[model samples]
Target chain A: MEAPDSNIAIAAAGWHFLCERAEILVLRVSREGAILHANRHAVELTGIPLEGEPLEHIFLGFADGPVGRRLLDRTGETHLANIRTANGLPETLYFTALPAGDEMVLFGQTDAQEQVRLRKEVLALNHEMGNLSRELTQKNAELAWLNAQKTQFLGMATHDLRKPAGLILSYAEMLEEEASGTLREDHLHLLDTIRASAERMKRVIEDFLDVAMIESGKLNLDMGVAAIEELVKSPLLLVSKSASRRGVVVTTDLAPAGQRLRVDGQKLEQVITNLLSNAVEQSPDGATVQVGSRRHGDGIRFFVTDAGKGFSEEVRGRLFTAFAGTGGQKRDGERSIGLGLAISRRIVEAHGGTMMAESPPGKGATVGFILPAQCLAPMRSDEQNGGVR
Target chain B: MSEQPGSDPRVDSVYDRYLASLLEGERTECTSVVEGLRAGEVPLRSLYVDLFQRALYQVGDLWEQNRVSVATEHLATAITERMVALVEPGVFGGEARRRVIVVACVADEYHQLGGRMAADLFELHGWRAYFLGANTPHSSLLDLIEKTKPDLVGLSLSIYFNLPSLLAALDAVRAAHPDLPIIVGGQAFRWGGEESLRRYEGVTLVKTVDDLERIATGHGSP
Candidate 1:
């Protein structure tokens, strides 16, 4: 005996359900355009007998676009077309035509208005996107212009401030010289204080200018090839007097000293001067500040180590920030301008180098920078001798 | 060294020594004089005005009186330029402000020492003062302004005849940057007087380095 829910029972039930409940117009037609049969819904909607009638009689026309051409050829594809209803009123329908056992089947629905509405919405969205793009471009231009203005104003103000400070320092120094023999010791002390204050102001002003230059992308590099030994020694000369005055001895350990690198000699000198001076300033009286350089794979690393109080982790976090000092007070007696490391880091990074600082509590601090060899490569044949390398 | 009634005797002697060296075309002597002045701790601005400016003025005056040839005058100016460079590093040290200012001589103006001094003053202050040299063409000057995008453009015209070029440059700069501040100076303004420059908008006349300092420190009224 066959089971009650067999495949044949399921197929008959599916066909019966489709013919009774499907909202689409389902019709059967011969290959020669003769109608064979029509579902109950199709006959009810068209109000015409479909069996044995020519398929063209009831449907006045079919669409001729891509979808309609598929339906005409009975290629089993869905199409959209305008068809005549029972009352001879025009209606848009999505029609699907298929072949079934020597007869053709067509399923159609009037859902063309929904597709039209969706297409209109997409066009509107595209228009809005175009407008938004134009607005973004306009805003970007305005931002660029405002940024330029800000840089200009700051540059002007910075330039105007320098000479007066220079002038004040000059007057103070002149007074110190002229009043030396005539003034009392206390009076001389006041003069010294004024000169020192003026000198400090000059230094701070210079630091501000440097920060501005680096930020504005206007720091010019005079790139040239020079002996690595000179690069290490020259900056020492600039700060030697200060170091000696502080009773801090600076020693150099330039391994592979004769190595040559392409760099901006003056800028590198400034970087070294800043770093060495800071090192010397941080070291205690009778302590040593060690500076060394060594070749690291396709690059050179330079370091400064001071035998003094190492900074706390808090200070190390902000060690390279402008105007940030060791817990707001320097360990050594030297006045901390605070911009040395900040400026030095910028200079190093601009030269395609990396700067870092490390201090393992009480072990003293080590600050170093690495200059990559790729950045130091000679740019052309002439630069090898003409300072272009 | 005879001490003047109201002047520092050391500054005067140093000034005299530099003047003699420049006139003699002794580059090494000029360098030595500057080094000595720096060693003695003489003021840089004082050296600029009392030595370089005064000496160049005397050279110009001598040329005017037919006591020195034009070539001698040119040599004196050139020596002063070199000396300015030589002494600059000693006088100016510190971090540079990121902002830029372009100092240019107005068209057809040959007196660049004044402008060079102004540039150095700016550099000393921490601004990257780009010295555009003497007699910069109007178009080139405008082009540089566009390229460098400086915060301020300083125009130096020492000859009265180049006043028109100065004005033209100011107009071009104004057109490009409607609100950019401009400072105008040079010997030309002394001859043309304030009346000629008073009509231009967004311009400041600086007669001394003090005025420049005031403007830089944001204390000047203009």
Candidate 2:
């Protein structure tokens, strides 16, 4: 071998140093396609040692072939390759190969123009997303405002109609009392129909008021301590009267009979009233409606079971939705307004409780609510002695 | 620019950390920093102007001075965009006033974060803000105005080179809705364009989020 010139050697060393520090990737591979050396940039970019590895390992989308040899054959032509980077993402790089002595040298650089195009596309997509998001936000605001307006209108209309409904109910009751003995049989039956219609109307109006208040986010509660047994028994008085008229028996099984909890006494009584009424309305003639309360998982669970045709899965799903009309017919063929259960559930939820309904096929249905332990207020002497004030 | 009211001094360090993470493309770290500030109850306006806006400006400056590569600046911008979106849920809360404003970037103006932040500020002040994102065409903008019947329109301009496009958009809006109010602002106004904006009537140049807030709440004119 001839001795290399010192000046040529020095220039070669300087070029080697430049290649090592270059921002682009530089690699020297053997003829067989195994990497002989990788520059600093190449190692740093890939975050792996490159010596003695096949050059194809760094590039993606190569078939089972000698990729390095083919690239070496195309000496000065640029080939686009996606180089796997350290960050677990592929980066597209343009590469050129050159024959050097008994090996091939590769240089890789990022395609700036391609990057610019990609950046533009990404920015456009991002802008589209942002515009859609803005539209959605605006639409949501409009819908909320419209809903508020509807709720306000509902509240006002219900408030105004409630007065007329009460007047009709009062007049019907007064006429029923004053003309019970003097009227003819048919006349008395007509008077009874009028009273029944007025009572139904009053119930429907009251349910509407409850729904309106709940929808307007104004379901205020006047919280007080009450015994669970008293709460259960108070509504039974009103419910038993209607149940007996249908030949349905009303019963109660309050286990923790003396259990006292903090709740809105009036609202809790309304919930019991709603549940018992619904049970009585759905019960078959001579069937029984049972009300029960017991300790359940650090809470008190109250449930009403009725011997009526069970609800299907579909009806059970929306049983507590207002105006869902899942409420069955009474013995007199009078339909319920379907807002009682919904309002009852809302009242229970306001007291930090949850409502549920279970109906087995060919069996009866049971609707229940559980008030959390947070509602279990210590019984004051006055509340205990005065029977749940 | 004056510091925004409710700006916390603690956010200065958070801004530095966020800018560093953004420039390095560490998205998770940036998210953590932003979430931390939000959890600490740093006011939304301060998060926008003090942290996000200030860091982006610094990143732009770094690119101008050649201290950072253009790719790094763009990475910072992309991260900041995500961070801004992270703050959006907090932006749309509170009761909405019955006013509506349509915000858009002028044609060929792609830097839209500032305008987006401004729209969010309006939302915070209870005005329903509809943001039409970057490079919005004049015709489409006019069509939206016709459809939405907005009470006000806002145009954003980022680069000074887009001043002509902004002016064209302004003229299109003015010709269509003669009595409609308009507000214009962005980094482009920092260099110039405010004087040119004076040619149109009922067009105000809002310079800060506070100014936008005052205008949105009907307390001050822009």
Candidate 3:
């Protein structure tokens, strides 16, 4: 065959280059959102075919979201949406305007299935909302009822039982003290009985108190902004006495002078101090106590770890509870009102955060808490001046 | 995604001929956010954490099944963390109007995918989720319970055998918050764990998305 002109050969090669190098899904359409052209990939996806067909003719096979319809209505208005190929599969379609002189060339391609799945998710979310709303209402109701029961229970215990128990405990203690003077052998046994009964009454009253405070939502938080540096020092100093009493070496990992944290210095200090004391009480003398903090997420996380006997799953279940000490059994002076942790939790929560304990039997225990950095929403001028009267 | 344009009838590909090609292993759709996540520029909720519980786990499974290795899992985790970071800033602990609940596997319980999945689901559904990262101590959990007193307690157990211990923990919480709803989900429910969970009152079990919706409704799933 005679050699074709160099110009003709060059044009043919250029056309092939445009097809292979570019990722455009070219389509031809009329003014009415009908399909006029469908590129190779677009044709592969939709399963519909031929050189001439309206867009809507094939779209009926699949569902469409708001973004999809908008693409069809606006000629020059382009949209990025997921579209189903004829195979009924979804694609993250990137529809763009391919200006073609007199006619508009509709160029499109997909981003990925992940994008399309997300869109469908928005529609599916309606169902979840309904579920959440219902769950919220029901849970709220349950909580309200439980609170009421706790209130009633506490009232009876404090007024009807606690006073009478106090009377018994007082007399028992008095008799035991008075008997010391008699110093008689027979009387010694009687004094022991009285003291024992007095201790029993005290234990009952304490348990009721734990139940009362945790349920009634009456825990008080003495709030303040204590520098993290100063905060760690106070707790460490306070717990030193208790630590030495039990032979535990207490350590404080305070951030430098510049590392400050907002807390109700009094309450947060009490929480740490109690946790510190609890550590001493749990561990044998000479064990190590580790106190430290680091940036955990968008908040600050403080931890108190003790190298001690650790805790059983059973004892740990009641760890922070009143009279629910771990290890072998509940010991004297170590009897938790259980109120400490509950109270501490309330204070931390009031400051907007969470606290937790981690102890595996034989592995020791670690208590940690995370508090969010302070927010900067300005209160209304009047609201700040006085409690909204 | 809106409906796709049909094939041009002029071309052919084997994938176009079969519907099964698109249906298998399909996952939660999240794009426009993947690039930033892969680049480590945004967190998962930002885009890295964007992979839903199922999608990311698949990446994990590929490694777990020995099809991939630790390096691949690490890459995926890095991508996930970055995505999570992207969205984490948007989620704040400042809001307390809605109870922010958290749940996790006990230290005795080894698997955590179930718990992580639950947390991811909660975040996607727009609830404040406190993910008690796995292997948490019972002491810490009890402390968390007292501290968070979340509206609901969601616990996940992957192995049926661990049901007894899971129930024990639930009982412990019951001692603290008798009214707090304890929701038990994950694989444990399938291994005839429903009967085990039911023995404890105030404890609800979920086996499906519908059950979860039931939980979201406030009836507390059963």
Candidate 4:
């Protein structure tokens, strides 16, 4: 054979350098699928020594018989293979194998068009997520502002209405005192009805004010030490009067009578009163309304049980939600304004306690609260003065 | 490269550590560096410009010099994108002002970090910034503008070759809403698109996070 010209030799060397330095994978493999050599780009991509290893080592899953023989059988045809890259991710590369005696030379490059499509898809999805996040933030801010406005409106309306309800109750009492002898029996009954309605209106207004204060995060607790029995029985006196009117019998099962808890006496009494009141209203005429307290799980549990139709699952789910009315008609046919349980739960939570409700179908409903052991700890000076504010 | 003005040497050390981790594609280390800076109370602007922007610019230069592969550069970008998101709760914690801004990369422009950072800066400064991510179609952008009625529009272009697309987006936005104020920025302007941008009456060019801050504070133009 004649010797090649000097120019052709230099050009051939330049082409070899270009091929070695290019951003493509170049591999020389034996017919048995063992890699004979790999160029610099291939070594960098795989981040491993390739020479003398099986060609299948670089592929994610190369079990199509012998990869080298398969590629050699269809020389000059492009094949797609997923190569394991240094990033622990698989990359799809288009490979073309050329036969060279007993060895197969494989050239591989990424499919740029497919990559561009995938990039677009990913970018679009990320953008959608970002937009949704921004919208959520905006909506949350708006909702917070609207809630503040609603609470403010409720506070003002209830405050303004409280004075009138009180005046009506006072005037009705004054009429009964000043004109009792001159007024007919039926006329005195009218005065009694007016007084009762005004009293009910005043209670509803007070409930609304409590809800407003709680919603606005101002439900401060006047923390003090008190016996659990005293906490349960003090509220029972007030609720018992109303229970007897509805032909319901109020009973107490007070255990741990001497057990003391650091709690707000007035607020806890109000919670007990609310729960007992709800039980009395929910029970059938002559049904038993049971109030009880016991030691429970490093805390104390107080419960009110009523012998009435239990709540359905749907109503039970939202039983403590403000304004979710008790899903049954009261024996007196009076509907609650529905803030009692909600306010009671918040008051318990402020004292580091939790509230609960249980209703078994056709049996009875039990509403209760558990004051955690933390409430038993002596109050810090700040908590004693400012309560749980 | 010039050091970022008012850059803290401590943050510079952090930047160096972060850059080294980023170049090596050590994602966990990079995340730790970013989280550490945030925990140490490094200002968000300084983190964005001095650490993230500075390191990414260096990576881009390294890619140009063939010292690092494209895959490594992309991995660095991906990691930095996640780090940016890690700081989002703080970014969006500011009390939102009544002003709103719409930000998007021009059509065919896939590099969205600059625009996203701009949107975050706007949010940090109390403006309600809505970011439409990479490769935003013109029609969808116009539809959003119509729906949101933003006080300002921002367009970002990262590749210099996409200058025409940026111009086309600006023209489409201007023709649709002539009086709407527009702010344009990104790596594409580093080469030379600012002169062409001056043709529009209400358009402004912002070069850095500080420049965007100036505009957000009603002090910057051109």
Candidate 5:
């Protein structure tokens, strides 16, 4: 245990520090493939006796080929190999060999267990995701099927309900006309209520069906060229009774008297009727509801202005939605399903037109829609510029 | 082949044709479009969403802008309603599950289309669906519920202003039959968002037909 020579001790200490601090498998082999030197880890990993065993003999258990020949023939070659431990357990290692004087020096690191586990997890996750995606596709198909069923059912309901409601209204009207003089005022009132109720029900059914049909892409329009007088007078005539009932004076102002529009007369009438009805309903007993139509730009602009409580900013924001007029009640105390304006806007837009509402608070409100000079496109072969040509 | 007006998927072209046909009062062409779509294997759901919904929305936009008249709008709607008959056979073919489902709009709520759609969805799920259209009297609705003893009840409120009526309907139903499952839908719920659904416990807010299917199937109840 006496202290070795200072030079020898220093060299020995340096060799030991280099081997342990490398943190990599370090091996030295002779030109003949004999094991010349090995670090602690290399020896432990390969389980070969240091400085004596032939590298070929040590790697015989796991190397794919003669490792000694492969390493000797190829300098600075990097490769992966399964090297066996003392107990014959296999651990994968990657290494690169470089010429070190007359011998070959190999440096490597064993593939860690964490990396292996992570790789397995990734593969499993990919498989799981595949299954999930397939399941999602299947669920979407099922959902689509259910949706189709729902649409169909709605169409059927609307159809079935509409006939009965229409029949009820028609019958009520017939009974009223047939028994007009014989019926008492109270009886007439009851009949009127029944008729009104049936009419309202019919409208509701029709609106429901219309929305369904439009949503299903089944709505169709008949386009025609009509005089501005007809467009203004038609809807006015429809709303005249309602206007007179509320004691609201009805007036009309049409500019450029003979100006005609190439439009859908029926749809345009509905739009006018809705605006006029709304206007008449909002007007006070003696207030006037004015209907006007004019040639504006390349289109006909029709408006119904009523001296009634104007729309608040909040109500205006949602005026075109399905539930229009829901934010506030009209002056007539009448409630709306809010579908009229929504439906009207869609009709005008379908005709390549626009609809709007304007009001100066306490100055009454003006509701109107515009019909372009021409429908943007001919909807069908038979409708190809039927009159516009 | 030239694309049919309502058959264009990119936009409202197909709906345009349909709307035009209705505007022209061409019943045969309108009916043909629906028949052709079905024969071509166009999914009914797509017809509803793409063709019908898009066209109707466009029609609404046009009418709102004063581009079309109320008469034309009504005609277009009327034609679309008739076209539903073309697909009626396929929609009402499911086996009856013996479960009654009642759908209705609240009192003073005149928008009954959403409820009608819900009722149909329930019926499609094999439930016996009863659609009490807009403004069902509270007493009658209660009586109908009692007589029918529906397994589920669906209520639709299209306008948010009708939330009070919805609440009233809910209270009436809940008082009459505690623990009954209720599902609510419509633009109102969507406009109000999730925070609105929180006002009532045990009432589920469903946005789409698919969501309604899930509820009817009992996979996603409130």
Candidate 6:
């Protein structure tokens, strides 16, 4: 005869609901003794209803082949061979039991819902990993492309510099030969052309070199004591012929602006030269270009004023941008690819000073730069300023 | 260390920005402000109207200092406009106030961000604002005012050059609508709102968002 109904039945009904609601399931078998009872896990697991049917039919069903007999024949708790579901699902099941009177087994099938969720999670993680790998690969490819481009750029810039640099040296040679004697007036003109072209080439090469050095982190400036005279006279003397030809008058009142302090003299000369020559080119024929210097507190300020076609709002907008010259640009709407002002600007900045410009359209233009006066040699006021001493 | 996204060390730096400042167009500070806005820990609007706008006004002082250019000053202005647009959505959402008509002065005025700021503030506060672009024709402005009959007409001026036109715009509005309220704001009025507020005989001049609140809420000036 059957004993009074056990507390396991109430729990079995609750387990049924947990399974149906959220796709969950629970199986309760006696872990103490021989075959007590089985729950309705079979309704979903065995795919059949056996509300009061004998427990043996479904116990055999919960196991496949001879697995059930081996399990029942045992008395105390024993780990049965990983039992298989009837549908041939690949999962391992374990059972515990009691031997005396009516023993019991507790076992549960693997939750299909959990398996599906884990499968999706694993798939998503794998896809994300793959995407990261692809992105890394793409970045490496981009880096390689950029390196190659940089090499090509340097190669081309060097080649470009060589072509003009060779001409500049050869032109200087011709100028030296002509300067002594046996130079015709036309030869003088050709010499002028050579010098101008050489200057232009030198400007380009210098800019290319400066940019390269700056890019490679090798642009260390050497500061020294340079006279204000050298900075003003050198560029003026170099561009003298061009100024004369263009009918532009370049006047300088160097007049010992300040104490020669610690500074990079060569680059300072280059800056003043660039500002003056650029002014000469932009000014109309027969215009006045004035260059002056004055002590500005701890620094000296240099100004180059050109009385030519002043900068328009358009040109002023793009003035400091490299390769954007002011002359043929306004006339033919053409711009230069030269690095004149760009190199000058870079050099000035390297010396720990600032450069600025003032160009009111139709009022001509003035370019100014300030350098600390600690780098220049002190000026002699005697003969230089009309021999007062 | 938290890294700001667009700030690449390999690219342009603070020195480059400084050089840009000494010459014409925008200073490095303009781009830095944009960078700050993009990072977005605090509301960009409050930061802008509070700090950035004051900083930009200092830039205007630099313009008066004889070293800076109109290009430089205007560049900062243009960049601030972009900043305003960038932060607008996060502060006010994407929905625009389609009903209110935003009235601004003519193009010769050339400066109207102060007006645009009010418009943005109004939009954030939940009124549909229609911007009358810049330097619009008088006939068109009046016609739009008549057609739209905006709940409020917000007038902005940033330069003294546009004062005559601003007054004319105000007068036209008065002739057109007797009951409709008008609010004026901008930089040209040095005393902020105190002087301009008293000066506007027939219109209301709001110095800031604080003053604008009273006018916007219908308790307009006498």
Instruction: Pick the winner on DockQ between candidates 1 and 5.
Output: 5
| Model 1 clashing-pair count | 12
Q: CAPRI verdict on model 2?
A: acceptable
Model 3, A142-219: lDDT tens per residue? 566676776668756665777777788787778777757776877777767766766666655654664576466666
lDDT of 4 by residue, A1-389 (tens): 44579778887886587457888898888877889989889998999989999988888765566554566678899998888898888888899998888888898998889887887576567656655665566566657767888899999999999999999999999999998999999999999999989998999899989989999999887888887777887788888788788789988887765666788999999999988988888788899988998878877799999998778888878887887765345444766667888888899999888898899888789999998877764334536687541
Candidate 3, after superposition: displacement of residue B96 in Å?
28
- Give the DockQ (2 decimals) of all models: 0.01, 0.30, 0.02, 0.24, 0.01, 0.01
How much DockQ does model 1 earn?
0.01
Q: Assess candidate 4 and give its TM-score to the true structure.
A: 0.77
Q: Please, what are the lDDT tens digits per residue for candidate 2 over residues A1-389?
A: 44679778987887687577668888998877889999998998999999989898897656746555667778999987787899889987888998889988898998778879998898788778866766676566667778777778878887998888888878878978997888899988888888888888878878877888999889999988788887877898988788887799988898675778889999999999988888887788899999998888888899999998878999988999987777667667877668888999899999999998999877798998999988876556645587432
Best-performing candidate as measured by DockQ:
2
| Model 3: DockQ vs. true structure | 0.02
* List of clashing residue pairs for candidate 4: none
Put down candidate 5 lDDT per residue, A1-389, tens digits, no spaces. 55569778887787687577755777788878887888987777666666777776655454366876686677777777666678787766677778878988777676668666765455445433432443344345456667667667878898999888988999999999999899999999999999988987887787777666765667688878676677767778888888788788989897666565667888788888888888888888878988887766866688889998887888887887875555356453545677888778888888888887899978899989877766422323336557431
**Candidate 3's TM-score:** 0.35
Q: List ranges where model 4 is wrong by over 4 Å.
A: A1-116, A176-197, A323-337, A377-389, B1-3, B8-10, B24-31, B34-37, B93-96
| TM-score for chain B of each model, two decimals | 0.87, 0.93, 0.62, 0.94, 0.76, 0.73
Please report, as a residue range, the 10-residue window in candidate 4 chain B with the lowest summed lDDT.
B88-97
Candidate closer to the true structure by TM-score (higher is better), 1 or 3: 1
TM-score of chain A of each: 0.58, 0.77, 0.46, 0.78, 0.57, 0.50
What are the TM-scores, per candidate, against the unseen true structure?
A: 0.40, 0.78, 0.35, 0.77, 0.40, 0.36
The runs of at least 3 residues in candidate 5 whose Cα sits more than 4 Å from the true structure, single-residue gaps closed, are: A1-151, A180-185, A324-334, A373-389, B1-222
Q: Is candidate 2 or candidate 5 better by DockQ?
A: 2
What level of docking quality does candidate 6 show?
Answer: incorrect
lDDT of 3 at A343: 56
